[model samples]
Target: MNIKKGLVLGISLITLFFTTPYTPADDKREEKGEEKKVYVLDDIVVTAPAIISGNEVNRLGSQVTHVTMEQIQDLNAMDLTSALRRVPGVVISRHNQVGSFGGGEGGAIFIRGKGSSRPGAEIQTLIDGIPKFVSVWTHPIMDALNVDIVDTIDIYKGAQPVLFGNMAFGAVDVQTKRMKDTGFYTGIKSGYGSNKTHMASVEHGGKTERFDYYLLGGYRSSDGHRVNADGELQDLFLHMGYDFTAKWGMDLTLIYTDNWADDPGPIDLSYPSDGRFNNDDFFMVATISNNYERAKGYVKFYSDKGDIDWVNQEGTPGYDTLTDYKNYGIRARETITPWQKGELMMGIDLDYIRGKARFLHPVDGNSAFPEETFRIFSPYASLSHTFGSLDNIYFIPSIGVRHLNHTEFDSETAPQAGIILGIKETRLHASYGKGINYPGIYAKVQDNLWMPGDNRWSELEAENLDHFEAGVEHRFSSKLIVDLTWFYDRGEDRIVTSPPPPFPPILTNIGEYKNRGIEGSITAIPISGLSLFGGFTYLDSAPDDLPYAPEWTFSAGFNYSPVDNFQISMDTQYVDDQYVTSRARMRNTVNTDEVDSYFLVNGKISYDFRLTGCDADWQVFLAAENITDTDYEQKKGYPMPDLGFMIGFIAEFN
Candidate 1:
């Protein structure tokens, strides 16, 4: 599809979806409804970020982070990277203030040194366990993920080979909000900040009898800190659902995003700059789920399509480029409790990826590449059972495997096992899993276009990872909690350019590395309406110069309501010096120069007053970021913005 056509469709479709009538047919529908049945994990998708709560512990032996809507509001975070910055072992690289730019650190997320490679990333982005990314490129497009409808974001800190297929080395799950109350509601919020930054969003949602729906639309823009750095995002999300019966229901979801950001080249580096990276992404998901006393399951079908336009590449052959891609899949899982304290889960996944790219102005004057496609069918299952003494002591041991059936490559079965020991409110867990990422068509595009004549991409193999993790959490009291964890990953068979090429450009799977780290966090509610949370991480990576892997990081924050209708929140963080690398074709080399360590502080304060005649309130808020005015860089030579602030207001009513 043409880039212009895709952009038009994205904008027009979003408008149409958001304009759907709010009122349901048959206005007199019965209001009586049965209590909702608890759905299994296989059916209920979720999202959160930073410091998972003790009460949310159910993953047995995995490390997870949780951040809620209230916390996101407190942080005044506008995107995934900002919202998740405080997550342990997490790092992000971005060149602009607003949207995520193109490849090469323009927009990227990393976890313990993984996911740094664009077009072949290990970290996966998901919405309700459904995979969402650049199908042809094989990595996530950050701009495509719209945060306007997010209720929470959950970060699973390591490989989840059994539960999630493909790019499961690490994962981010975004859980959209669902209406709970029986009355219709509306919300509006807008803000203006430093660098001509402005944003506005509105939403409507409600639950009625056997029907429920949520709809949202938003826009954000900024004149960034540097020339050609401006960016903007427009998005819409809608969800409609109806209960077929007390135990079964169905939901249809639509999400669309059109966003673009420009790259402001490094100050110290002299290179031809790529001016802008634009994207139009859309997604549709349909789900049918059921719940019963001993069994729960779901079947989901999803399609995600996107068009990326590389507006400029000043000196490269591909001066202007466009790539169109789509990903579609069907997944289903059944979770059953065959006997008391015992659970079994079985599931299957089928995925198809395809796309094509064209250079509007190739320096070589040749701009055609045939479209390609890849297919994979994965089936997995796991079982867990609890064992323990009469009281206060018990452990759940689990095991599972996923067989990858790829149409273009040999298959690999990912195996995972774990054990979780619980002593009352304190729990200890350990787990190990294997992860695999097939060499998608992205690799093919690279070799066929850049290799001139020697295309070794056809011989390239899949990358593999062996991961192990262990942790312990102790809840001293309902008001205080602490958790700590350590992990090690062995990565091998990674596809890479034949190093320091002198004559031939060859891609091989000889790359290998080991990464280990320990991270811990604590959350405390010292007094009524006051929350305090802190976390720290230490990493040791061999081939030690891993890109974006910092040695030490720390974060702490507090939210307090000192008086009625008034609130205050403050957060601070520190990042260690780290190397910046590049993954452009044969230029895949780690930069020796390290970006220096830096400290940052951010805070927000708000006050709310009820509207006189309606069940609504308007909240005015003030937020400040980089309060220390520290000069730092996330990507080498890309200096961050100075201290700045924003003023905003939010209103809601039923």
Candidate 2:
């Protein structure tokens, strides 16, 4: 352990020493007291910053990436996973194998090219103020939820304010729509896409006197392109708010989701593969909140249950089973004050999870049940202060600690700090923080497969990361805006699994690695009714090879409104070579190959008209993806679909 820690620190120091950019924190001490702009990084871009900006670009402590609800609606996005594609520093991957290997579209979302490498939860997710992480088996589990429920998504890419508590390795907070004080709304939408995919949804909201409420429901199903690959999804969601008095208020929400998919066999090139796979999931949540002048807080509870069935043809062994999981927590936060120059926020949170999965071998009628459970208790706080000429600069520092009751892991504390500096029209920012992820039920206790006898949860290892990021954001004119960021991450004691010899070969022991990258983006509203947006990402990852970790990613788009009710838009994405791994082996032993980079183009056109009597507006649109139909592969032996089309319509009430 001593030698390993020494090596990790040594490597981190060497890597950091070579990559650090000299940004000259002092403007007055430049070149023997002479002031002249000298380039630090080879490439620099200037652009209008997004309305919701971050500290990374401004020399502040942290950074916040923002996506507006307006943009989400414009794209007619199906889910949060689909809508995030437009963000600057994100990548989405799909496994397009033949039969049973294709149910995970919109299942993988990566920020900074580091997430989604293995099955276990790699990042922390949040809705409102709640901390959430999906089970490894169903990565990207929120796909069934509609994006219409979101008011906006705020991504604090690096470390965040202290109030967030531990788990900032990539913090993402989603803000749901709030009830309006005096208006009513109703909307319905339906759509059809290639491969027999269909979707329909309805949502309504209103306020009566002092009470406001909203309800949403949707159904979607698809007979996918591959054999035996089909899926069906249904969702119901609600939000309500009331004012008990002028100084206090409460909000409530309830959600239920069900998903079922026919498993397609893994990739088969020779003939065709045959197999059966299916899954079902259920979820529920309730929350209550209060407000008082300068302080506010809330608490919520969550629960879920799911089942899975898998079968192989030709007398081969198959598995069928049901799984249940339940989680409940109480999270309360208070905002101290918004003084003349700065603001302060602090909070406390706690959570507990209990889960179990049962397995059955159908051929011999054998069955077993594995007990998996854990409880997590975390209490954290943060502080933010701003001061400078005209309050143009701000600094934020945060810290958090968590206690675990599990035997495989020990208690841990995480601390972070960042600063943002504004000079004239340009801003600079930098921040550093630590993060840790706990082992899942399957990794430490049970291997799910029948071949196990107390694999003993392979001593849990905490992954510690120190992130250093800096960037410059500038706006030279009204029409053009540019933003650029550079980031370095050092991961210690990275947990990785080894292939089985006498034990079920799943994720196993403690490992380590390093990741570093740069990102840049630009948006231009050069002319009235015409707009352009584009961005690029460059990354390098080490140790275990990851399939979706592309070296280069780029995207560009143009939107134009030719007339009052008609609009046209086109976008393109470019992905460079990536890697794919099939089995466990030395990082160097695996066969290395390229995915052949390609550009994908998509276009859409829409027209809006009014419907009589209902006081409604109608929209009709068509979308063409992969206009070139360029063939590509994200996983070995699996070819993605070509030239897909989708047509959709929507109605909204005023």
Candidate 3:
């Protein structure tokens, strides 16, 4: 640890704590009788700051940053990875301009230097609180996350075992959109951009006294900027709900997506090869929820199934592999306010995974495979209470624990605690949590067939993480806010390959690593319709030398509406040079290959207006990415696209 830096930060926090002005809380708040607050990282992003990736502090008082739909539009992002590039503590990598890479390191998202592990990842993705990923590979399928259906994205910075388990060392959850007002509404969007990129989407939503429904469908394709590097994506989703009573309701959601991408090898390929990956995914989530004066809870059941087919055209003898997977789970939680300023919460999560993979055309005597199942049952509870006077300063403390039971492994227990202190517009928070992750079924399948003698895969223990974080946020005015956070996390018993070479690759658990960092952001709206934001991240990792964890990251952006219907937005970022592939991780050998640091700027301009006699509002925008046309590469041999232009329009009406 850097003692000097630590001391400086400590002194700064103390100084801020003493200087912030104090104000009394409002005791006569409106009553929410028989209406429980379902805190699904809950926050309605009705504010204007969504134009830039922004932050929010939930009732829990820890870090829970977010990016709203308005923000996604400003960036003209069409996919999950692209949509998160500007968020603090997040870094994304990809090979092509339009489509996400499937087999290797393409379309990967890393937070605070974690999630670089391929075939298995530390970071997880969720849709409406339901986990979604390429179960066979134990990682996210970037293309499967359709941004057209997302309303708000919540980012949980570090290990949050109490709230989310297993793959949630770092997590991003996309909350689906729901109709807010009565009557019916429809939205249509379309765009055309460089590299022959084309995209279109349509959505309809409505809400009544007792029923609400939302439906969406979209398609996008690109003849990428490189030879044989084309991609296509399509998606359909529907959501319906019926309120049985003022305090009880049920809802169901169905999602489907089909996408494919082609890899044109490296930039300078001596011997060319064509690699294509295709995926078809479908999932559903159903929930029965209730709210009351003293208690609120919901039971959610979800199921997902997907197939991935990878055609590797290595040399002239190309081969293909297909992986089939299915996932089912239930999530239920309840929160009860037993007394004044006191509450208790409990929840359980059950996840089951089953899958099989095999080569379409036999190779190295590796032919068929048998299906296997993995189950996870975890239950958790927590309590929180407010202390101090409502007329002055106040404090909130929280503690929680979770028990993990896996069908294929021994059970484990994880715990967490947190505290929040606030006065007026300033807040301070601190937290600690433990994270655990077990190897995916992919590990066992490989040992069973490809390497016949390696039957010890099932003997590996789950990995563990110790996470800690502290932060302070101060809102000077309705338009200006500043947030600073310091975090550190340590890993132990991480599984990695032993003697990674010509001998024999054996999976083992002798890896350990730790990372510490400081992240801060400032959002300012000096005048009406104008918002400016900037942020930076500094990270330091020991002995392990984590990959894709840039030591320094900087981002800045601004959104301005000079007139009622005219807008301009621009975003810029700079990332320090860092290693690119999983080889830098313990799964293989750490090497010296690294990518160069680069700076980028992107801009968008739009106008919104309503036809003279029509009630519908229409918006048209022109977006340009990589305005500087700087040459940069997130991975070796795969250079990102230069300055590109996109023209798009949107129409909405009731």
* TM per prediction: 0.91, 0.81, 0.91
Lowest-sum lDDT 10-residue window in model 1: 38-47
570-630, model 3: which lDDT tens digit per residue?
9999998988876432454674657999999999999998887665679999999999998
Clashes of each: 9, 28, 1
lDDT of 2 by residue, 319-403 (tens): 5544555555666665565775454555556656555665556656755555555665665555556666623544433333333
User: What are the runs in model 1 whose C-alpha is more than 4 Å off?
Assistant: 1-57, 315-318, 389-391, 499-504, 583-588
Residue-level lDDT tens digits of model 1 in 615-647: 556899999999999999987778888888899
Top lDDT hit: 3
Clashing pairs in 3: 34-293
Any residue pairs clashing in model 1, and if so which? 47-152, 47-153, 47-154, 48-153, 48-154, 49-66, 49-67, 49-153, 317-363
Q: Which runs in model 2 stand beyond 4 Å of their true positions? A: 1-60, 95-106, 132-140, 159-168, 263-267, 270-282, 304-318, 338-342, 363-367, 389-408, 447-458, 497-509, 581-594, 612-614
Q: How far out, in Å, is residue 470 in model 2?
A: 1.5
RMSD of each candidate? 5.2, 13.5, 11.1
lDDT of each: 0.78, 0.57, 0.78
